[model samples]
Target: MVPQLYCDFLQPDTTARHTFTVKPTELAYINEHLHHLNHHISNLIELRSALLHRSNQLTSPTYIVPHEVLSHIFNQANQMEWRSPQQAIVLSAVSRQWRQVALGTSKLWERVICQGPLKLYRDSSLLIQHCASYASSLDIRLLEQGYKLGAADKTFDTTTTVLSSSDVKGKLKALELQRIPSPQWIHMLPSFLRLESLSIISGHHPSVDLSSLPLSHVYLNGSTFDSLILPPSVLVLHLDDYFLDYAVILLRKCPRLIEFSSETYILTRAQLPPNLSNPLALNSLEKLVWYPAQWFMELASATGLNIPVINNLELKDSEGLKPAPFALLCHQISASLESLTLTYFSANDDWSIADLRHLFTFPIPTLRKLSLTDWSHRLILNAICALTPDEGEDGYTDRCLPKLEYLSISSQDEIFGLEFDFDYRVLNLVKRRRIGEDSPFHLDFSFCSDDDADYEAQAAWQPELLHELKEFVANRPVTITIKGGEVELDQLSTARFDDGDCSS
Candidate 1:
């Protein structure tokens, strides 16, 4: 279908040594042909789009749905919960009417979560255009892509402008920047007053200097931040893989801090800093979470800090942690701490069952909620029996933690095995606690497994436990929850729980 002149122009010449050496006249002819082809394609596309729109209007249930209903449906279809943008694009591509509706729905554009780097970098310009309108409180999650100069610079620059925009300044609520190459990215972030949460996850060393940013919650993971200079505006701070000196210094800065969480190996055999000999109490701090049980010992030795008001304490880490530090910690904060969560990475450590029993001997009178994950039945029995003292033929002594209301016990079903009467132990605790109290006590006995290979086995056991549990709480004001390996630990059931509440 080619003309003689066009065929001659298009054919590759073997005699020519250089490439793409077309004359000006030939280039102009090629351009003209391309223009005509592009126009023809555009006209065909418009015609096809119009036809599809008319067909959908007549045949689709989507056409019958009201705008408000459609908008709501689109909102759900758009993965706003995960802050995804692809679904919105699919919705917009359905037809002309759908495209208008999707673009008009401002909530769909609220989140820009680009998981892959190269795709995000290549499509940066178009993606911004799609999300720019009605993005009052935008949440942008950029994953590290290839480090190609052109794409990287363009992507970073575009994002910088977006973050610095007037609308974004007032409405941006949370920003998660993971593996973004430049630490200058932190400086490029203008002071976002509305920003409540910020997570900077990087593997490389981060040179972060927290200025007067109104950040209520800040989480830094896998960073080599040896020192910290935090603003007074911070309330809740979580630092993973940080030095003890840095944590102490940061805590000194945030006087009104409420909750603090950190994970570090420095505490395994950590020594106290020279300036931390004297006591420094944070009366306002209510929650203390530390990983690698050794950190608890380090924190105890961290005499500079006296977290008097700390009630919720969570200790997590691998095996081989001694109990002396835990005992010392409990003795220090036993008067104030009400909720205690202990989790072990591996179930190999003995953890001194006797040491665990000795813990209840201390005066943790205010303790109410206790969670033991991946612990043996002996430990569970020890924890429960610790509350109620066993007297011989004489009489029963006053129980420990008489005000205790909630108990949560979780472990791998495989580890617990079929030998233990987990149900009976929990029932005994419930009966003992519900003796005369007007209020009911809550007991959560949950079993976890690796996969669905044992789901059937776990399900079979649940009914029997549930049946027995019902009999025990028949007339008593006691709530016993016998859960199998079904309840996911991380997923939140409702909006009342924040991202921090769900994060590991």
Candidate 2:
């Protein structure tokens, strides 16, 4: 379909045997046609690119999701996984559409976490500014670089400047500051009107006055309480690695506390507050978690601090707890207590079977759930044995925790030197508890061991015990789980139960 002049122009030199001359006008015409063709080809290429883009948009899975729904998904992701401004940047970099959605989603920029060196915080100022622009309320976390940086550091000044900014200060709701050497920034706390939750984990023991703020939840770790002032509005308080005396001081101040946890209280020889003729009652208190120590017992006895409505109690590191004090504390709160968790108890000479029995001798009829974790085999066995009902001369009667509906026990070490009779005892306890109960009874036991010999021994007896228990509770409202040495008997029973075979 080519014209003669055009073909001659397109031919290679090797194909041209004779000299063929043409008019300059004909050559210009050929050039003009080639330019038109080139322009048409450019347009076709552009058309192809547009079609491919359109096809990709139609086939992409995320393309079907509306912009608002996609933004909500990003918001949730930002809350759960990405609690930093960097998350916003990474999300915006995914695609053009995602960038638009992420930048537009105000909730996605609500929480900004800045950790590492001062330089990092300085560099992230623009991101923080962007976050502050989009979000009405913000939760910010600023973790200091490992070393001590003084108030004189330029980075610290930059941080203070950003936080003192009109937009960030008014919208801040929750703030967590960790390991910053200078407590000078504590002066800015009262300026944050919207701040409700504050966590300060520093050894500086800054004198903080929170009485003017409307804080509801406060967590202080490795911080002193000598000069700290708490507001009456606080609902939940967590004091970690603090002196018992300091905790008592704080507790005495917060009358409306609903939940209070104090971990690893440092025992002090200094006497606590003198015993009041009338008990300092926390009638509003519902939950109490603390390390069981002699000082706490003495303090409770001396001050007569009453948590009459306390329903949940957890005692951590109760390995060597004395009997009389433990029993006394339990008896005081036994009337309303519903759940009890005892953790980190190991084998100790002082923690004998009789001690545990003595502690539980007082009836906690209101108790419904009990959990024991990281306890020695002997202690766990004794605790369960104490709970197991003995065949009295009259009839079978429940001993302790008679109304318990849930029991969970776990140990990380091997049940060394204990017989398989332990498992039998557990089975007996389950059978006795679930006999005529219409309510569901749940028992979970985990005694995983890393030793090969222990694993083999457990493997040998676990299947037989699991089969017996499964067959017995086949049609009852009882759920029993036993996990030994890396293997979960619950899964095995479930598989067999699904297959309609309870005997295997």
Q: What's each prediction's TM-score?
A: 0.66, 0.73
Off by over 4 Å in 1: 1-109, 129-133, 144-153, 165-171, 190-194, 226-228, 264-274, 318-325, 345-354, 391-397, 413-437, 446-472, 483-504
Candidate 2: Cα lDDT at 84: 62
Query: Candidate 2, residues 1-504: lDDT per residue as tens digits?
Result: 111222123333332453447677566666776776677676666667666656655654345666445544444333333246544324544767445545655666677766554455555456567678878788887665622556777766666788889999888999887875566678788788888999988566557788878899999898663487888989999988877767778887788999998876456453565435656678888998887545556667777878889999887776456777787788878999999888877767256666676667578879988888767666777776666656551113545666777787755445456453566777777666554356677776654443454231221245677688777777877666543122345654331121122112
Q: In terms of TM-score, how similar is model 2 to the real structure?
A: 0.73
TM-score for candidate 1 = 0.66
How well is each residue in 1-504 modelled by candidate 1, as lDDT tens digits? 111222123234333454556687567766876776677676666667676656655555354665445544444343333446644434654766656545655655666655444544556434544566655556665555623424247766676676676676777767777776665566655467677777877556445565666778888786655444667777898988776766677777777789889887554454445687657667788998887666556656666458888999898863557777667778788888899888763545655446766776667888988777655445555555554445431112355566677777755535445655655555565555453355567666654444445241221234455465566567766654444122232221221222233223
* Alpha carbon deviation, residue 344, candidate 2 (Å): 2.3
